[model samples]
Target: MPNQPKTPVKGFRIPVDLYDAALAKAQSEGRTLTDVVREALHRYIDAD
Candidate 1:
């Protein structure tokens, strides 16, 4: 089988402040918004 790209999941709403902060952090670190959110969610899930 050939390598495949992952499909992105969407349609969640977040608070404006949280979105702004994440956007700012992503910009500062030169990363995509998806990358930042994915990392954050991974950390959150692993913390339990």
Candidate 2:
């Protein structure tokens, strides 16, 4: 996706617990939080 932002997105607000969970999941998978979140959002959008 060449159109993806070159920098990390900032200032988005989500629950601390949710953030922690996503962080842990990303770490355990050896991936970035952004990658994890992006995949999640993709899945969610495609789910319907």
Candidate 3:
């Protein structure tokens, strides 16, 4: 099957403390900040 095009990228500002915390956790876990945030958002939405 052909690959689908990815969604366009978007940017938003977050608090410095939140970014720092996500960066630290991502580094420790060997993952990107995007990965951490995506997982977090998925869990949050699924909790509804």
Q: Using lDDT as the measure, which candidate wins? A: 3
lDDT value, residue 20 of candidate 2: 97
lDDT of each: 0.86, 0.86, 0.87
Q: Can you give the TM-score per candidate against the true fold? A: 0.67, 0.65, 0.72
**Over the full model, what C-alpha lDDT does candidate 2 score relative to the true structure?**
0.86
Candidate 1 global Cα RMSD: 3.8
Off by over 4 Å in 3: 1-5
Candidate 3 per-residue lDDT, tens place, 1-48, comes to: 149577678899999998999899899999888778788999999999
lDDT of 1 by residue, 4-47 (tens): 58766787999999999989989999998988777889999999
Worst 10 residues of 2 by lDDT: 1-10
Candidates 1 and 3: which is better by TM-score? 3
| Backbone clashes under 3 angstroms, per model | 0, 0, 0
Point out where model 2 deviates above 4 Å: 1-10
Clashing pairs for predicted structure model 1, backbone only = none
